[model samples]
Target: LDAFLDAEDVLKVEGRLSRSSFPNSFKHPTVIPPGHHVTNLIIAHYHETVKHQGKGFTINEIRSDGYWICGLSRAVATHIRHCVTCRRVRRPVESQRMSDLPVERAEPTRPFTYCGMECFGPFWTKQGRKQEKRYGLLLTCFCSRAIHIEMLEDLSTDTFINGLICFIALRGAELDMNRLNVFLTEKQCDFVMNAPHASHAGGVWERQIRTVRSVLNATLLLSPDHCATMAIVNSRPLTADALDGHNRLEPLTPNHLITMKSTPALPPPGKFEREDLYGRKRWRQVQYLTEQFGSRWKREYLHSITTRQCWHSTKRNLQVGDIVM
Candidate 1:
């Protein structure tokens, strides 16, 4: 008993007797042990003492006061999880998982019929021994995993609108794509705006941004002279085959339209043939690309649906106007 007191300060001096007092809260703080004869009663007392703080705050207070019982965190969490007062005052959040992907995302559809877009970067480049800033806008096709990149000078709304117009014009001519307005109003397409701070909502475009950044970083390191697809298309001179003239990268650029237009993959062993009709082959690649897209999409969607991680069981939630504190 003497050893325990010397070892810890769970009990603090208070006149003739010692009482529970955590350091952070000087207010009437008491530590509750689970095995006490009046364990429930003591918890109820402390809960009221702290004015019904949430599980984390209450647990912190317990720790602060140097009073701990076995499973203290679990006890506080369970207590708050069931507290009617807290439940009523605080809105209960339910994990209402979305009701499956729409047909455009799940079923095979036109490449850009459903797409996700994002803008990132002010990528630094050494131009004539001076650093320059530039931003990239990425458009990811929901169904095909195809990407179109647009370089932007800034993030102004006007700049974005202009980039969109240019992208739309180029794609409109090549793919016979419909207007963005008509696609949503007449074709049942959607243009979703991801809620702020909810990055998961933009997973499609977010992943592509990460991938493009990594690839570009690596490519730049290995081949600083390499030209971007857009640069070549816009007729910038002297683009020496992006991956350093290495034969290892030939497998990724099997078609001229895709090759001349840009790159993919880490290449392979041996020489590979470039398909006839570079311009048409770019569009033709979509034929096989759709199968690969569907296969990958289905595999991922199945994995996502098979598990209920964390909040597997439902608990009784608080009612409206429940007393708190």
Candidate 2:
């Protein structure tokens, strides 16, 4: 305060001409002491008045027309960061490292064992005289690259549970198949729901759905009828009883369906030659196959770990003590 009395390092302030040497808004040049609260408040007010402009604009507006404080840039940056409008609009830099493969994708399991499930559409279907909408529940396999789809009636919880039961029945014919869904309590099975806004959590299923939608859209344009288009979409050629190596075969891989150019695309990868394994006590055979799958998956996972670029590269890091929306 004593040194400011001599007007050293004095900065112009907006107040009418006054006798104070310390930054006085008294319409004359005056010095502002370091870490002064009044100057910060004034800068904050000016920053907002300028509608959250950058440091350069804020400093220029204040210095050229109003005041010039030491560390003006630092103050303006802080003020802009804390501004409500600026905070709301500012986006944080994305993380640099990609997350490791999720547990389901990394582990070897039966196709459809660990799946990402989602529902879409109330696509119109013709029935007798009236047209009605129907929904679809898609089950995307995390491993073995298989998918199982089921038609749903509505968005009700009962309908969802029923759809799940239908899927288990269709796929688990060899297991102790049961039509009796006699569950005494709702807690018999736990349900996992994805976060409402975090669509990335379900991107795997979303990609499969988008691919299917693209194909369906083009096919329907030509076929025009829902049933016929679906019939063509669902058709898959039967697998032969044996491969040349006498090894058991498996059903169609989702990769083939997702990228197929024609229906009934008869290819060896689509054949499920392991159909004969579905006899009584098929659970034992399934256990053996599951182990083999796990082993093969481990090898593939190791190889993939060495070569990854999808999630590579670092992004700008967030600033410390900075405001975020």
What overall lDDT goes with each candidate model? Answer: 0.53, 0.55
In the range 153-264, model 1's lDDT, one tens digit per residue, is 7887667767676667655422212355554444343555678887766776797687677766765421232236333222321113333554533222112223222222
* Inter-residue clash pairs, candidate 1: 22-65
User: Which TM-score value belongs to model 2?
Assistant: 0.59
- Which residue runs does candidate 1 get wrong by more than 4 Å? 1-41, 44-78, 82-98, 173-191, 220-325
Model 1, C-alpha of 280: deviation from truth (Å): 19
lDDT of 1: 0.53
TM-score of each: 0.47, 0.59
What tens digits encode model 2's per-residue C-alpha lDDT throughout 1-325? 1223334654444443355554444345345544689988878777767777778878877764536577778878877766777767674535556667777676544445566778877666666777777777777666544555677778777787787777766554211101224431231433456899777667767866775566556653221443344344333322222223646544333333333322221222222234535756655454444443344434443344445556587566668965454
